[model samples]
Target: MDKKAAKILMSTFWGGGGWKSVSTPFSGEDFEYAKSQGVMFDPLTITHDEIVQRLHEIHQDDTLQERVVTAFLHSLSTKKVHLRSALSSWALTSQLPLHTYLERRAVHANTSACGDCNFLRLQSDQEYVDADLNVLNFERIKWGGVRHGWLLYCLMDLELLYKDTDAISEVTPEDQAILVSLLEAAQTGDPKDSARSLEKRWKGLFPSSKQERDALLEIWAAAGLLVPTDKPRRGKGGSGDFIFVATWQGDDGYNTDAALRYFAPYLPEIL
Candidate 1:
């Protein structure tokens, strides 16, 4: 492989920061072996040309290559990494134990679009969202591939259901109160009954009809802040029963910005 490829893969095994000289069970022999082969233990101290030479040496020695790659993978599996080295204001809202998750998970991002200019905004936004989505998918996959099936599902549970800054500001205080009430009613009471009550409560909030009240609720739901049960159950003789549940617990899942910020450290570096 080329030096660039070697460096990248080495980063994965040694971590983005490269190998440290800290004494550990795996460090002693592996460090000595790498140094003997002209490969620096600390990747940060090596030049690209040096990395290329080391990779060439490994290529000619089958046993050495196998040993090195195996040792590297083992070290990576047990080492530590951070999802975010620097915290931002937005990250304060993350409910996930991000650091713990990072320790056990291998996070990667698609860097193909990093410097694209043709459709920069759309591409970058989509990539960012996809990267976060990939993290969630990775957790689920590791937990056996069921939807929300990860044992540590909380790691993927970001508190961003209503964290849209624009949505918050546009939704007035009076409307916010109604939304919260509706959310509680949906989660705790009968869905149909709550709908009626909400309509009644809507009378003074604004002179609006039941349909208008429902429309307002739909608006918030469409804004990704709420989720209503898609399946309707038959109740009694023929009444359709529906349930509404807040997409988030409290203000959770509202801050997409924080989610990205917290996950940035785990992403791939474009060089």
Candidate 2:
């Protein structure tokens, strides 16, 4: 491994920000400093083949974490899953507590019980079954070989979703309008298009508060509806032009000026 890559990984691991916080692990200055030290590596410079090669190399270790990471990376790079659907599912399942079903059972029984007792007491009510299914789905993602970055991304998206719309059950007409407007804007294929620019253009359609609009933009990016522009020079500079990768280190802000492109291939289906 390159020493610079190792250094970057170490920094990312020890860094601070998380799904609950607005800040990122590394600030803009950190990227600048890394560049000055000749240690910054642009993710855009890496090709799919190179990524697969690296994954192959990492798979040699055969460790559980390595295997999980490799699988997650492969799925992401290959676009194996429908991002919009996956995000929606995550948002829905994440809202409920992991032990919601168990708690409901305990409440009904009106007694403290061991794990086996709780399992035996499980009811067949539709609501309980739905809650149990939600918990199961959440657990699968939480402990079933998914990457932490993706998990964090989902959590952050859910937080923003609640903050902006206050519900995850369904997409309202207004939400559909906003999504359509975004799709139309992206269809223009303008290289200068950024979240700030779009927010300005659709000011009437978005929330009045700047912070709320920013939250919505962040949620869109996390949902993979909006992605960093493919313009090579844009992401090359370690400045304010980067996408949210849900990683601890790196740019995490909405980056209103960072050009974004519509990437939801399933938008029409959803709309």
Candidate 3:
């Protein structure tokens, strides 16, 4: 594992900046709810670096390692990493067993972890789904690259697999219609068309409240499916928004074949 590459990928995968945890101080009702879950949760400032660092600490007791890895996986399942966009990075230190899990779960489709990125296959079991659960095709998912000693996703693009973390956990058929419309418009019009305009035109698909819309859009941006374009104004501030761009055939690098093979099924409707 390339430590240098790992750091770079971590920085990007975590969405830039250093590992900084912001505390979410639970209050009255929230605190009570947390206790019900068996943890007196006082969310603290914990960075990804800290988590990865703990993964490397080889103590005399292997129990500590197990606990750390377990906690890390739990975090992955529950917490939303910022800017976790279509691109992601994974560390390959001796202590972390994630590589083994990825290897075991990888759906090999005549691919390798060479060149720019590495790819993997995920299980379609709905009950035990991860962030990439909605993407039913194994070939569509590809990741590769070794920066320094760390494993990073390279030459890959985004595809809508998960609905994102929010109160709206599932993508209804209506939501699929919205996505289909967006994709159709993107394919025919100028590439520079404003996504904000599209949203405004399809206002009914989003929450009526501005605050809710902003929040939802932020989450969508982080998911890597939307690409933001800058629409410059005359001696004024720039405007525009990210649109749905990454599809089954958009990515041209390491996983083109896989993307082509699998992304086709999602056309005209999002599952």
Candidate 4:
């Protein structure tokens, strides 16, 4: 498994990119997430140059592309770690596994995880269909090394009906509406009202109105996005325990469970 390399790859993949978790690890754990791989990097400094360097190293042997993608998707589905960009700083540390997955999938051009990844392929079934792009462009899909781990949840939800990975992103408005309602329900669980909550917490992302705040958090929570973890900001007592979210949509229990499983597979694997 190249445990050390995987740890590094995990860290760089999340921290070096801009992706992190929104939920706090524990009540006082300031960070929303931590890298099991331990690849330390600042998301702010990550650039395409760095990504290209990492990619060159990753593509050396493309056999393990599917494995690497699986590992990453497992992480995404479970929320152990979320990346900021697809450039994959994690690959820097995880040489063997990364190479293994890439080497295997490099030749499988029909659905190569190592190829032009316009969308995520987090499926047990290997049939990939790169069809329409609703919310983002292929290149624009990832920036600052991060984006919402929406595809994982989409795949899981769609898999209930045995759908293909190609059309998973097309999550219907009815389903999204249902998720939004779930987010609204969860948010109301907090003591604060939407107005106060918006002012006190989510000012940066949706500082305009309560509706905007609700909408923003709703999308994140409902879609099961990963906030950041190695964030540099400080909070109460000048400590790094408070994870200030611009907004959070919701994190359905399924994604939360999956996230923990991915990062700490030993727990479920052992049990």
Q: Across residues 114-223, which tens digit of lDDT does each residue of candidate 4 receive?
A: 43221222221222233222112111212211222223223212221122122222223343333333323444333223322433454432113343333333323322
Kindly report which residue pairs in candidate 1 clash with one another.
Answer: 159-252, 159-253, 159-254, 160-252, 160-253, 160-254, 160-255, 161-253, 161-254, 163-254
List where candidate 1 sits over 4 angstroms from the true fold.
1-179, 191-197, 224-226, 229-232, 235-271
What TM-score does structure 3 among the candidates reach?
A: 0.33
Candidate number with greatest TM-score: 3
The sequence of per-residue lDDT tens digits that candidate 3 reaches over residues 171-196 is 34554454445344333234333434
Model 1 residue 247 distance off true place after TM-score fit, in angstroms: 16
Q: List model 2 lDDT by residue over 1-271, tens digit each.
A: 1345324433543345522222332346655555454333222233222322333343344342222222222323222221222342232223223332233444334212322223332112212111111222222222221221232223322332223211223334454455456445544445444556654554565433443334334444543445554444332333252233222111222223322222232235543
Deviation in Å, model 4, residue 36 alpha carbon: 12
Candidate 1 local accuracy as lDDT? 0.27
TM-score of each: 0.21, 0.31, 0.33, 0.21
User: Model 2: residues >4 Å from true position, as ranges?
Assistant: 1-170, 235-271
Output the number of the lDDT-best candidate: 2
| Candidates sorted on lDDT, descending | 2, 4, 3, 1
Per-residue C-alpha lDDT of model 1 across residues 19-75, encoded as one tens digit per residue = 433322224454445434332223223222232233233335334322322221222
